[model samples]
Target chain A: MCELLGMSANVPTDICFSLTGLVQRGGKTGPHKDGWGIGFYEGKGLRIFHDPEPGIESKIAAFVRKLPIKSEIVISHIRKANRGKVELKNTHPFVREFWGSYWTFAHNGQFKKIKTEPLGDFRPVGTTDSEYAFCWLLGKLKKKFKESPQPESKLFETLEILMTELHQKGVSNILLSDSKHLYTFCSTKLSWITRKSPFGKATLLDADLSIDFRKVTTPGDRVTVIATNPLTSNEEWNLYKPGQFQVWKKGQIVFSNE
Target chain B: MCELLGMSANVPTDICFSLTGLVQRGGKTGPHKDGWGIGFYEGKGLRIFHDPEPGIESKIAAFVRKLPIKSEIVISHIRKANRGKVELKNTHPFVREFWGSYWTFAHNGQFKKIKTEPLGDFRPVGTTDSEYAFCWLLGKLKKKFKESPQPESKLFETLEILMTELHQKGVSNILLSDSKHLYTFCSTKLSWITRKSPFGKATLLDADLSIDFRKVTTPGDRVTVIATNPLTSNEEWNLYKPGQFQVWKKGQIVFSNE
Candidate 1:
């Protein structure tokens, strides 16, 4: 198993606050210490930083904690070796390009016999079950949609079906994004919190830091954060039931499998 | 124009010393300050750090300089943004996965009508002639070789021919690597230097720093550094002629168009 942290916002936002709490679990407060990675998307530009080191000890993760790289979408993960060797290739937050957009995926649960499926054009560079599932999912999507930039609703429906297929095999808790939208599927554990104009103060569960969201954000700002577990103790985190899937855009939940 | 930096080594070597010099060119020493990026290949795992911010001032670049992530192949670029906007996607070096290996490319020159070429299976995530040319090149190779993991010699020959096609159109000075081989092609300015057993001291032209290679390296180590210009003032660098293509593996030149 691994840990995942994701963010979506109406305005460009940084994940330093959320990341600080989650990275603690990477080797400090928790046991996931194999490796970690994160990706930030600015429009069509996707910037990724991967380190085959524990996130708590990684200098790059420390840099990320200090620097406020504002982005509309972000995904991060801290992994514990299970089905794959602990290496840079097996680091979480895997990416593949399709339909002229870079798609990012990070998973958090063990799966059984997922590699038995055939992959199309996209192949996994890493020998991880997480990467294998991503390639398989993307290949299925690409095969169905001969032309890309597909209608959002159509794409979302197809994605849910694909997620269900993976769910049939084993735990498939995942956070994925295609620059424009973020899709999160929960097999067992996933939680989220959305902050809007009337945002108040919040404190990190693992760290001693606290922030008053109102001080930094405007009245029109909206932000949503998702993770395998609640990162903050104060916020009202909405937990997902098993086999739940949700899609987000512009900081709002557009669709879901209720 | 932009500044390109690349390395090939018989052993896993860090490019920190050379990167310290090249990054200075991002703003302090040169005018190519739009953006910068670097990719390091460790086996099949590629770790990349991209910043639309100038490398000289980027905290990420600063972190990269201090942390030594050793690798056998590296490609770094500081861009001036001639053909595309100063953004993350347009920042070199651009990467795409093909033949189950991560391919990295960095360009130092511009092209006129490179975008007019048709892209197959791969598309540019950014609006840049360099990315356009890379997709075009890789797509052609993929078409010819239906199966991946193609013979090294065959792939090298096909790549040389594809590079010639780009050279015919306009400036296509590029540094490309597919984990196993580093392919360099020059349409204008490009140079290289190889250091081996009897390594000597070298001084950077852009910074007031020097390294005595004999103190840090063993006689069994061999390293090849390539750049748009001579990065060090004290070292003897070999300049490539226009339309020349060379392939390097394990820090040794395997083939050339000489």
Candidate 2:
């Protein structure tokens, strides 16, 4: 099993504070020390770093901690081998190009006996069920929608139907984005927190770190963070109901249907 | 390294569509197939799943693909070995209880030569620096605000300073949450997207998938997603600039300083 961390903000921001606390779990406070990767969105582009080493002890991780990369959206992961050899190719937060945009993906669950036909356009570069699923999904979407782009509502509806079908096979919890919006679904555990103008204090549970929101943000800024679990001790985290799904855009909930 | 996925929305929604595509990366499309884990925030609690197998081939992953777990917030991760022998103990998305609330954390990146003195209350259960960092952060937060919670502004100010110091040591891209608000910092790469009533078509770059947002969401809903990279091929993704910090609350950016 692995862990997940993400951030969505209206203004460009760095995830250093939350990441500082979460990175500790990679090897110090928690287990999950296998490899680690992170990606930052800069306008229409992405900056990514991946390492086949424990984040707590790897030099790459140290470099990342020190670098100050700011963006409106961010995604990160730490590895714990479950399938495939521990190598660079097998790292999470996989990236690919499509429709002239770079797409990245990562997973934290296993799928059994779930096989899909070889995708003509998209193929697996590695041998993990997660990759296979990604290819299959892409194939399905391409098949369903040709050249014309659909509206958000229609797109979400199709996704909901597809998700329901996929969930029938096994457990699935996921986070996805294309730089414009974030989508999430849960078959198990997932939590989130949002910060706004009426800021307050937040104490980290994994580390003895605390932050005062009032000083860091303005009245107009809004931020939403999603994780597998809560990261603070003093804040109120909103837990997703079982079999729930939601989407976030611009620091606010855009769609939800549990 | 592990992979992370997250979503936030105004209305309840499922991430099955995105999860399906992401799952493929766990073991099929890309790599990251050592073990997988997921967390879904349900109301005030979280539903979680951890599997010590490739998500593409694991039975649980298959089942999850079809599950309909829904939520306003979601987080997921896939693993690839980097530290600690591959086993359940080393999985990511580590959970802890603090201030009567469940906190979760996930890290991407590595740290080296971390020799910070061990704190009193928090300690590492694993040899990974990630856990040590978590403990250190928690310990620091506890020590800073031992008596009462400070204003969010004050807390964030202190955290910013601490994060800047920690960043000087290593690569640190992280996500942390207490259910109400999310904190993010990027020492490296991270990206995000937001969706609202005027949703449009989104195509997956890793897979041949696309969604029409207009079909599934209401006009009042908004969603935000953050990741290490973008997941779609046609949508615009916002990247974090170098050396940035920010906070998210209620689906909007609350504080930011790049």
Candidate 3:
């Protein structure tokens, strides 16, 4: 019982608008109030802000909502603490380095028996099934391919297979990134929306705020946002069926298993 | 060259007072204006703030300086780029995970050819000699000890040997932590100060700031601050000799190579 938010953009973009709505679910409009974390990728460097406090009351989250830190890829999570104790170490959107790239992952559902899975080089610092699952996924990737596999399709295929295994364990809706692409596997609930040319005004579902994309974005700007639930009431969001796997690059879906 | 700052405390303590003076050196008092970063350890979790902008003017740095986020261990850096371009990826205070602990590293000197060193599992996300050296060191440790080594002294000795090799290459002042101990290696310059029961007032060297440690601390609290150069003007500081390696725990020096 958590919430996830992710973004991929053709240009560096901020998630303040989406994040403003998501933070409401952290405490105000919903019950996911244990802790919150967000990761923003600025080139190859990743900056993460983690607060054990409820996101609705987090000073850091307020600062982040106001300060527009632009990034090509972003991952964020608000926790309800189903598998681990509420602490800074158990905050979601966990990160690790593999093959010279920073990989970030956020999960929105539970896995019953992920802890029994063995880990290799990557180990979880916290006692969360979500983190254990991330380490397990990354360790499998590292073991199967000594280096980043060439002809990216091979890597995508491997990810699909691994994600399928995780889905079999339990509800495992995931949003992951390898600095270059955003990979998503939905076990239960997920939705996404892409804004490109002719972008119009949208109102937040949780708050009384509206933004006209035409005023802020250029025609060339393309941005994709994925979340466990729709953040905007006006915008149309595409729902993913269960067991769907997708790879997104530059705000567009490059591969998908329907 | 860059500037480094670190802290180890017997109790959870804030480094805002020390960081206030150090950030001034990022552009106002010294030449390290390329970027800045700091990591604060909260139990087993770590929170880091990195800015490619100069610390003197960075909004993030200003917010961090005002927030009294207490931590038991801290590592920070202000960079003056030499080998790498001025970008977020090349900012100081790099991080990696090993043996279920997050290891953070910040370097204050140069390595002439450290990039040529071979690596095993750990890899650098940025193109910096300091990060290369960290990768090489951690990779060697992972290779030698399958798990965390028993008998902590053995790990310290192994670190000393690895750091000596780094010192041979060039100037390699380092501050590293694995959520437990603060490991320091000095090639040319480093200093430390410990404050306990008899707290006194101190004045900053780079900023118009003064703090009375008596007003903020209790008698049982012991705190150690390490930096490339002493941060305060009035406090007496202990200087590390060239090629010195030390391990610190709970504000006390556990082992040192004098």
Q: Lowest lDDT 10-mer window, candidate 2 chain A?
A: A94-103
Q: How do all the candidates rank in terms of DockQ, highest first?
A: 3, 1, 2
Question: Per-residue lDDT of B103-191 in model 3, one digit per residue for the tens?
Answer: 99999888887877789889899998888889999999999998899899889999999999999999999999999999999999999
Q: What TM-score, computed on C-alpha atoms, does each candidate reach?
A: 0.98, 0.50, 0.99
Candidates in order, interface RMSD in Å:
0.8, 19.9, 0.6
Interface DockQ of candidate 3: 0.88
- The sequence of per-residue lDDT tens digits that candidate 2 reaches over residues A4-43 is 7788889887787777776788889878787777777765
The reply for model 2, stretches above 4 Å from the true place, is A116-120, B1-258
Q: Where is model 3 more than 4 Å wrong at Cα?
A: none
- Of the two candidates 1 and 2, the one with more favorable DockQ, higher being better, is 1
Highest lDDT scorer:
3
Give the Cα error of residue A249 in candidate 1, in Å.
Answer: 0.6
Residue-level lDDT for B256 in candidate 2: 81
Candidate 1's displacement at residue B177, Å, is: 0.9
Score chain A of model 2 by TM-score against the reference chain A. 0.93
